[model samples]
Target: MLITDRHGRILIQRVDYRTTCLLPGGAVDADESPAQCAARELQEELGVTTTVDRGLAVDWVSADCLNAPASMRFPGEILHVYDGGTWDDEQIAAIRLPDREITSVEFVEPARLPGLMAPGDARRALSALRARINAAGPALLENGLPIAPTVLDRALRTARARHHLPFHVGPVPEQLSVVQVWGWLLAPDGRVLVLLEPDTGAALLPGGTPEPPDRGDPFITLRREVCEEAAAEFGEPLFLGHLCEPDNPYARLRYAAPLTRLGPPPVDPATGRTHIRILATPEQALELFDWGLPATDQLTAVHQARARLGIPRAARQPLTELPDATDLTTM
Candidate 1:
């Protein structure tokens, strides 16, 4: 199992009898699958319970290639690596170590893995890390298998680029008038709720600029704007962070989540703006935005939300024409 924190730091454990560290996983019991073993071992060794998702990587290690002592070497083994989703500081702090076996647990930066683990183990960990990175972007898979060196290299490049990328919203301008907030309102069927501007037939997330009554809280602003613009009530918004262009520093790109539509949408009063919402798959949404005036920041925010929610990237394809705009005025 490959466990990590929100910051992408890998969680490694030091065995009581070993000098090299390994991930929090062990041999599967007779009745357990690899995924079951991963989750059970995590809680037994680390004191936290987490879901073990699908395999990230599967590696066949030959007995001759093993880095352990000759006496301890066994037959070749096939390892099933699963993703132990990101945890926070509180979860890390709550770890309960079984001193008899797991001596210590610590999160280590991926760059330092070479010095901390055995060569073979380090290679496995690095492969798992790359898989996690690729999970955040467009993944390269063929015939149910990930392309070897290319996928790994692409993931490494993405990870390096993201580490250096700036994600900050610039200094607040004195005359900043509107703090715009939006929602990536997801449905159970994996469709995203979007709004269409009636006048220009432009696509937008279901949100708008904050009004005076918003009380300066972005969450509050989001709730109000979503209701006013979409005529549908949403649950409390989870802040997904911000996006901003260098030239438009005052145009804040705030997103919220756990979006639940309470009822049927009523027609919006705002002139030239359609209240009719569009439920599009992530791929369709991308194409729709491409056909209209693209809101790059909104698209970025959508990707961020998807990453946080563990949603896979949609496969890209060309569309000859855009979908018909939904007209709220007729509703």
Candidate 2:
């Protein structure tokens, strides 16, 4: 079973027998279906009874692929992964592991799985996680490799190389140069705009560096870049925060702006690269962004700005490409 908490951290176990951490599950018993086995294993391992639905992934492990004791006679196994659903703080608090086998349980960030678990296990877990988030039904895998891989799966293949910027929810320091300006361009429904690279599925907020035409003004750069990248217009922007990396004297500023008009999909004039525009809730936006935990604080700042700007919380929905000319004034 693949389980996650509200913050998107996956539940992994430290078993006394294995050096690599494992996702909470055990061998399937006879006369039980995969779903039944998932539920049973979850309850037995974590002492929590939750309904398991939607097989996130199915993997066929070849015989002799696994490292096992010589006497165990390991045969090929068909593995099933099911979504255990997101657990709340109270539910997490209620978890009780047995006295043996599983020595401890941890809710770890998905990015850390590679360092903690076996390589194949890490790949399978990540694929399953992407399946759940993509809402594209189940994924098929062979030895933890996706048969028909997803955009997210492909993007996450180099998880260790992802860049992270330390976010600060305050004014950009006066001594530092404001290097880039990005907008948390929020629709009336409170979903923020995210720009996706058409080919690589890389995500970014719609903004850019200050151009000569921008007169070195961050807001002007924001407006021009938003128009260039997402083909959109917005009302006054409220500065939410900035991000700075170590050994750098520059800051990347972020603002929350109410989107006024959304035009058709845009092909960035500078790069001539067509970008996909999508509106995602702050939580989903955080997932799409590769930044680490500090991204959460940035979103929290965006939420405060949203409340002050009187934007409504968007209802949960699957992420889809932004349609042309969504008039927000009438929404």
Candidate 3:
């Protein structure tokens, strides 16, 4: 069972006998199906009753893969990884553990699984997580390795290296000044444009600080910066919201606009670097930003803005280079 909390932390169980922790599951019984066994195990072990409808991954483990005690002979088995579903605070509080076998359960960040579990377990957990985000159904694994990985699985590491920035999103404070501006510049398909730094894999949206020539208008700053950095033009802009950081006097403004025209990639005069432009779904963009759980709120805002704009939700696809000479007038 691959269980996660609302914050995307995985549920791990520690056993009395094993040095390494395990995901919350056990051996299957003869009369129970895999899904039934998963539910029954949860009830017996954690005293929680929940439906297990989604299968995240299936792996075939051979006998040679097991590390068994000399007294116990190991046989190969087919393992099924089921979606335990996301648990809220109330549901999590109701969990009860059996006294003998399972010692404790902890919700851990995906990045910490490597240090906490065996290599195979860690790999399977990560692959399962990526599959969930992919929203493309379950994946197939062999001994915990993805046989055919998704785009995110190939490019994104479970232990995503991210820089933590204190950020809060809401209406811009009346008294606070605007320091920087960024836009969720959307294409016809509702995918947002993101600028990627080739050297660091860092991603950012188009827009930047207001320039002296802009006369202090944030919209002017966004227009100038988008053209300079992305070689793109956008139609009328819609104010999405602003983000504030503690002790910072200036608020970072965010907007959404339909991309009008995209020219060939050009060297940004301000930074002298040509960033790789990518169009990603909102979910994929959140992973690329690597802002942890708070990103969910930002995503909600994004979807709300999308609704107001009447843009269709973009389907999940592998990250690809944004093509130049694209025309959205037809859309």
TM-score per model over all chains: 0.47, 0.70, 0.77
lDDT (C-alpha, whole model) for all candidates: 0.60, 0.82, 0.79
Model 1: per-residue Cα lDDT over 1-331, one tens digit each = 7777655568898888789998888988998988889899988988888887667777777778766787766766667778876777888788999858998888766656768988777777777665554444322333223455431232221112121113333444555544676677654444566665544345567776777777776767777767777655555454555544455545554554644453555556666354545555554554333212233444566677666765555443211111333322221
Of candidates 3 and 1, the better by TM-score:
3
Ranking by TM-score: 3, 2, 1
Total clashing pairs in model 2: 0
> In the order shown, what is each candidate's alpha-carbon RMSD?
14.0, 5.4, 4.2
Model 3's C-alpha root-mean-square deviation from the true structure amounts to 4.2
Residue-wise lDDT of candidate 2 within 93-143, one digit each (tens)? 999999889899988777789999998899889888878776778889998
Model 1 — TM-score against the truth?
0.47
Could you tell me which 10 consecutive residues in candidate 1 have the lowest summed lDDT?
156-165
Give a tens-digit lDDT track for model 3, residues 129-224.
777766667888887888886435543343445534444556777888998998988788888888876555456789898878999888889999
